[model samples]
Target: MCKEECPYDFRLAEVVSKLKEIQARKVLVQLPNGLKKYYPILRTTLEDLEIEVFLSLSHSWGVCDLALGEAKKTMCDTILHVGHHGQVALYTLSDIKIVCSPAFYKRNPIPLATRGLKLLMAKGCKRIGLFTTAQHLNYFQELREALSEAGAKVHTTQIFPWMPGQIIGCRFDTIVSNLDRKVDAYLVVGGGIFHGLGLFVTTNKPVIIADPYSNRLIEVAEEASQILKKRLFKLMEALDKKNYAVVISTKIGQFRLALAQKIRDLLRGRGKVAELVVADEISPSLLLNIPWAQAFVIVACPRIAIDHQEEYPYPLLNPGEVKYVLRGSLEEYTPKDSLVPNLSLNNVA
Candidate 1:
């Protein structure tokens, strides 16, 4: 649940009013994975407004494709996309009227447990690293100072090229890789799973995540643990997994495709036989040739790759930072262990 003073309610009301005015018959409402908690509320609200809404099960790319199809079929007059700054990848200005709501939380001026300082004092962790989504960077300077006074060295990286308000998933990896091996442990301040989990997975290190609105450090840690356990089980099933041929594309715009290639190489090095599915453009027909492939990993810009793979059940590896699970054959691949850490919070103020 959001804090009692959460600002998203007012914004949701405004967006809903705009949506109602359009009265689209086959409206597409794309909800981000982070906002899963509010899916029921959003769906109920849209239904109450008498709008025929279809929720895209996939991420940004999938949402765009659904909206595009609706536009092509003349099935819907408008699309309402919601979530973090990264959801911008879902549309072109011509296709749909995009409304972005970047979520923000006010951090208490007081430090919460002085995590950085405690690490420094206890383990001599001089070089502390800080990473978070773009929306939360406004308070970074203060957070940095608090850590510094706690006798720890600090380094900060902003994953989004734009301001905190405009940052999204597109720049996640670029920022995360910049901090590789640079600090002892990472400290993340955000409300969603993408930012923290993305950092945790790629960096392969212990991360301390803190959220001010609710008791998210523990909750998120639990969610991450469950996800990791599922991922691990999936990996184990793949031990005898000869049914799938992973595809890597050279298409320049597909960063996820490039990352898919990297993952393919890693898998092959571990004795898996994966195939590269190169194409001028990603389409269902082009992917159909690999009938033996239980899953295809398309790495490209999220917009193009995800738009193309909307109907597929294969898991997608996003270059932007997070490795997302898509609805399809790979859903059954579950892990045995949790990858996130459950750190206790000291909510000051």
Candidate 2:
């Protein structure tokens, strides 16, 4: 049973409005792995509204993973993607009208345990910038008030429609945009070390977690360090490599064919052998089949190399890390652009 403590609820009016506007029939519903639980309720609601709907069972990491094939398979003319807003990925679905509605929390400032605040206070965090996922945005004002009452000056920056002082796993431009502010520490209000560590890698600031799910406040110093250490070790392994496989994606949003070709050209110019390996989904077992490849420079989904380096047999490196491996010498090693390519945020790489 979803209790009052549950922070996420679908905005039915907005979702329904968009669906009706598009005149959608035989709609295909796509949800992130975590948001799939609400599908039954959603199915029932849409059925009552006289719209045929079916669910996509594929794994949805972010806006990057859209079930276009599943939609076509189900003969769906329209797709309703839940949980995340399609900001990062540029998917060009012409015939299918894809409507993205984020899971909004009705309650403002969900009273997660105060232990996270206490932990931050103990670590001498007076000025705190409370960051979280989109699901937790409604609770920010309440969180800010709580922090203020606890004798702390909190700084919160809004990132327009997608993230309002909150962040996703892939995008950490919030910290970059807030570099002018005098923030002592950052509090990632979401679950897991993924978002926290992403912030740490980009800003190198002190990051602590105020996880609502576990209701435990913890520091990410150990986890962040471990991730960096793993990345550094992978770079060391790839330092001597000449032959490399540039993994490319066929997925619409994640397809970096152009970037993959550019990296390949750059590698060839530098007297290195490069091959383009096309994949829809990248996994260790899939890559293990082709173990002939010396090293892999990931072009699709930066998280594959960032979070899952140990899973791969050879060195799996990011674009910037690959450059360092080619150069064999670093001007004080640090991560350039994280996931995505050299857009505006990743100009460093």
Candidate 3:
């Protein structure tokens, strides 16, 4: 029998209902790389239906990587975006049937951090800001109550229009806008170091992650610090590079063509040689052709510069980091507008 837990037992009935509602015979299914394990199950489940299923085999990190274009290219009538929320970045497409099925992983016995109570007490962190991925949102109330009972003043950023306490990798606007000044530290309530690290970088506050699977308290300071140090080193190294390629994405949400052009113009004014490289997808393997450039400034997803810099041959800094390097000061390093477009800064300096 198929388990009902998350990572399993995706209801085929809903997909059938949606397909029938829209009268869609051809469907395109897009899953984040991690959830691709469900591809076979999903395909098999849909085999008997009156739908033609096509799995999107593209590289997708977040909503920023939705396969809308691929769906259009393949002439799919409906798009099933899995693993994340229904909030695909593009805004203008109401013509096609777009179904967002978020993958869920149920945590029974409630993965509350009772054992980590001692660790939390020891950290000397009293005012805590809580954040998490959407998967663990169901247990937010229990987890918050548990933390509060442990004698810590807990706060979750809820200003986001999406799920409360939810911090997606690219957008930290929810945390930035909703957090009170009294917050001394952050507690991420899901697995993985990515969201926690992003929170730490954006807030410059100490972050701890509560992994549901392990139910252990993981301090993200050391790892986040190490990554930031590498970025700083790269920035310092690239400060002297005269030739830079400002990369822009052609995707609907990730596009920053104007920003890329602006950066290129700024570099030229500063007596540096610069060029703009436009592409739909970015990767270390994809960027290998531009060997003539000494450095590359990314106007794509902010995570590329944060996480994938080491993958590249040369320095790859985001717009804000590039500005910091060029100016050589943290005095005015406000990355209000980063790589991802239509990103709301809302006066978060």
Q: Which model scores highest in lDDT?
A: 2
For residues 1-349, what per-residue lDDT tens digits would candidate 1 score against the true structure? Answer: 3434443442556666666554455666655565545666666766877877676554543222334444445456566666544323223355565544444444562265264346434655567676555345556667777877877777766544444322233434454556666787666666545555655554555566666555345323466566565544444343455444544434322324545566566556555566666654466666666667755444544423222334444433333212222112333222211221111111211
Which candidate achieves the best TM-score against the true structure?
Answer: 2
Q: What are the Cα lDDT values of the candidates?
A: 0.49, 0.72, 0.70
TM-score of each: 0.50, 0.87, 0.86
For model 3, which pairs clash?
none
Query: What TM-score should be assigned to candidate 2?
Result: 0.87
- The better candidate by TM-score, 2 or 3, is 2
Worst 10 residues of 3 by lDDT: 340-349
Question: What is candidate 2's lDDT per residue for 1-349, written digit by digit as tens?
Answer: 3424445677766677766776778888888888788787678767867889999887777667777888888898877787766222222396777777667655443455256666777888778777777667656667777778877777866654555666777656555676526777787777778787877777776788766767666688788788788777777778778888999877667787877887888777778888999988899998887767788988887878889988988988766555565566544677644453542212233
Model 1 ranges with Cα > 4 A deviation: 1-29, 33-80, 86-97, 106-110, 134-138, 164-173, 192-194, 213-240, 245-349
- Ordered from best to worst lDDT, the candidate numbers read 2, 3, 1
Q: Per-residue lDDT of 188-249 in model 3, one digit per residue for the tens? A: 87777877877777777777787776666778878877877777777777877888999888
